[model samples]
Target: MTSFAPDSIVLNRKLPLWYQVSQSLRASILGRSPQDSLRLPTEEQLAGHYGVSVLTMRQALKELEDEGLITRHRRRGTFIEPSAQRGAPVRLLGSVDAIVAQQSGMTTELLDYGTVAVPSGLAGHFPQHAEVATYHRLRSEEKTGEPTNHARNYVRPDLAERIDPADLIRWPMTKVLRDVVGASISRITDTVEARLADPETARLLQVPLLSPILHYTGVTYDEEGQALDVAVIHYRGDRFSFTVTLDAH
Candidate 1:
């Protein structure tokens, strides 16, 4: 049996439990050697390991099954798919550095730029703020020109004032925060969920209505712990595989 380190399987309560579990298991599945066929722990055991309920663990396993990473049989337990693709491209989570590297080579298109009153939906994320600078950007593959991501960025008015539109077209928002806004980003908290595309998002990404999308909400904080930026990004699930690397030690 391959045992995952405790740090490797730790879950963030802020994110959906099932999504975190699924991503952890996906990393393990894809990390397996081609000749290694391993049977995974029972739902109850996995639930215990991750400090989640069995029902939650079951939901996590179902996500893997949906992705064809594992097969579950009554009385026989769950087993990894021997033919699962290895070295698949996946979006690495839990690190800003990794994220910046992953975004390299992608083309960015600025869709909308304005300073507007914070919408009711985002009001809570930016408490005490009535207005913010908002930028809508669409990202695409440089070669294929296929749209991969759409991000709506709400920045603190002061920081937003320093951002150059041309800089956004050239680099990721985090880089802009550090270099242009001079905000010392000390931490970033991100939560991800699977959602169906709304009409506007569907049209923007050129996907069919109700297509499955990966919704990411991220908040970046400065050294003093004040929220500097809130980003709501939608990624085409079909175009990206999300992963979190686990330490074997």
Candidate 2:
């Protein structure tokens, strides 16, 4: 119970402090070294880190437990839940590689694939010649037999044409980019939003209508910073989570 938390955190008045504390701890657990079994700082240590009392830290830990992020034993310290043992920490640096390089044994199932018009607002994300030479893919994943992400991806026409649609099912997008287009990825930018799944999207993800989900849209750029592709993915809220680390300076 005397161990201090790993980092210092700042809280804003915009949201509940306990929730923010839970989120910070959740990120730490998910971003932990995969080789090590999940363990946590004791409540007293966490209280010291956040400059809060043991009771406040306990309330924050309770939030994580409710989210299936942690479990406590009577004599032993809190441990991360075993069922949620996914290692795919989506770091912004070397993103797709980080996402694909994981021990969770993620397999893809392609649902739909074909050329499509680039959506209107995405003009800046594509070159002028790419009026319609884009492709979209809808696929789901089997992560240890649990359906995890209902992903939708898009590739620039040239990149899309370089590989067979069938290959999309067998390979991760990073592989296709390397073997097919052979372009050096320079940057990735994305936005995450929450929405209620509609009937069709629900059917795709196998979740119920109106269930909460995370929707992501992003653009990838090549070494020259030229936009290479655009992607949209929907993750099953119950099975997937996104974590990002921030700095004050």
Which predicted model would earn the best lDDT? 1
Provide TM-scores for the models. Answer: 0.63, 0.59
RMSD to the true structure for each prediction, in A, is: 10.0, 9.0
lDDT of each: 0.76, 0.64
Candidate 1, lDDT over the whole model: 0.76
Kindly list the per-residue Cα lDDT of model 1 for residues 1-249, writing each as its tens digit.
344322245565656677677766676565444345478778888888778899998988997787777899999999877655422345555545445545654679999899999989888767878999999999886545778789999999988889998999988898899867788988898788999999988988899999999998888988878889898999887877676555333
The residue pairs that clash in candidate 2, if any, are none
lDDT score at residue 85, model 2, on the 0-100 scale: 47
The parts of candidate 1 lying over 4 Å away from their true place are: 1-90, 246-249
